[model samples]
Target: MEALGDRESWAAVVKEEEEEEEEEEEEGDSANNIGDAIASTDDEDALKRRISAHPLYGKLVEMHLDCLKVSVMGDVAGDLDHHETRYQQQPKDCNKYPQKMLHQSDLDHFMEAYCVALSKLREAMEEPQQKSMAFISSMHSQLQEMSAIPIAHSNAPAHPLPPPTSSSGK
Candidate 1:
């Protein structure tokens, strides 16, 4: 009877230890999951902030929107031109004459917007071109400096080569 009691106690202790270990593993998994979720959220927010704050990103987005506006304006202008041409071809015939397509005020507005967009695009292009030119100039100067450096060879003369003489006497 005493031996049986000792065996029962040992079994109980073992079961308790297993349950504790399982609970600990579950807790660790939950912590890892929570950490991953937080990290993912942080990364997404950081990306959004970076995109919104980037100088080039804003410029690119503006340019894209301007281009879209310009495209729409061009389409409208084309349609107007077509109508004007048809009207001109048949000015006397009311049936063939084209009706008023777009208001002059609307055209003026779109034109102004188009001009502004073009100006902005040109400005953007100029900045990059200026930077590129400066970079090119710097690189050219560096190359010139590098070329001016005299290289030493084992079997070459210290002085530069003499000018070649004509085969025929001058």
Candidate 2:
């Protein structure tokens, strides 16, 4: 019955292989289930993962301290070697700027004046100053500060930015 003994040993090996395969699949399934449960809980963390490694802020507004908004832009634009855009190294004379700067409102009266242009953000995208948290946000996006450029040049191309796309779709 040597053949019968050989058959039994072969069957035992096949059975052991099947059991190991099932165990490995179960471990992979358990990891995926935990990942799915955690994904639904934290959306902001997910968004950050999708965003590109662009600078946290823009570059030009740091060029000088002309207005309250410009001064705030300066802080966001600091530490620039890591950024995508080009910026001038501030001159040693630039360091002579007052250690203390004026409050935003003290620098701009129109911060209160709501012109059709200036007032629109106050009307549309945001609430009135009395209700707004803009001052406390610590940073604002590049688009919000464009209206008050200290100097203007026509050659600056009016190239529209491409619409945003998620990482998966692209």
Candidate 3:
């Protein structure tokens, strides 16, 4: 009788373990379904997540910013630390650049030029612009004045930017 009772208890234990495993699998499937639904809702967000997950994302961001700086201000030295390619921590020198410092027209013009170059580069590289756009939007949001950069205006004309002319005439 005791042996039979032990057998019955072991069967009950096995059943409970199987039930727990099934519940855990169900929970995992539900979580995956939720994730898939969310991902499907916003493809851009999913692209951003994947881009940021890349091991060299930080380096890519820094390099992109450096290229942007060059596009904006020409290739002058001393803006970034050489070893780490990090921006230098210099005190703001508004007096030195009174007319040129973050003027709306200049910012608009430079950014437009940069966008043209970026599009060309994207085409040459044969990579989708969604990844680059995600990085750019993220960087733009980090700027101190949100209005410094322009998003599209409803009334604005959708025209392709002209090729940027070199001031150096090169």
Candidate 4:
């Protein structure tokens, strides 16, 4: 009779342990699911922040900026080429004085505007590169500081490890 009671009590304890394990697993799964959902969201700022936190963020940004700079430079080159072509295509004879002067003035103003636009674009590109450089420098310093910390065996003696003994009597 006593053995039967012990068996029943043991069975109840085992069942309770299994229930607790199942609950813990469920909690873990839910937590992982929440993290996944957060990662999949379409928030631009959040994505930028996450990318900026990554180790390769600086390189990625630099490459992207380089591509943009190249594209802008290409555009400027094309515009200049088009302007030159247009100028060459114009008739050299100025039979109509007022019309000739007006066309020349308009062409000069357009060229000036193109130069200003190019300058602005270059300045804009430079600002982001400078900011990214500063950010990358700060991140590198932080990583260095983190690595300098002795996380493991910190409580151990400061003495260096003993040199190994030679296997063959040297």
Query: In TM-score terms, which candidate is top?
Result: 4
Cα lDDT, all candidates: 0.63, 0.46, 0.59, 0.64
Q: How many pairs of residues collide in each model?
A: 0, 0, 0, 0
> What's model 4's TM-score?
0.31
The sequence of per-residue lDDT tens digits that candidate 2 reaches over residues 17-112 is 999999999999999888877885565564433221112111223322122232233456353432323433432232233423223343233223
RMSD of 2: 28.8
TM-score of each: 0.29, 0.25, 0.25, 0.31
Model 2 error, position 3 (Å): 1.3
**Model 3 RMSD, rounded to 1 decimal:** 26.7
Model 1: per-residue lDDT, tens digit, 1-170? 99999999999999999999999999999999999999999988865654433333333444554444444455775765565556446424322322332224554455456557766775675676678789999999999987777666435677879999878956
Displacement of residue 127 (Cα, Å) in model 4 is: 1.2
- lDDT score for candidate 3 against the true structure: 0.59
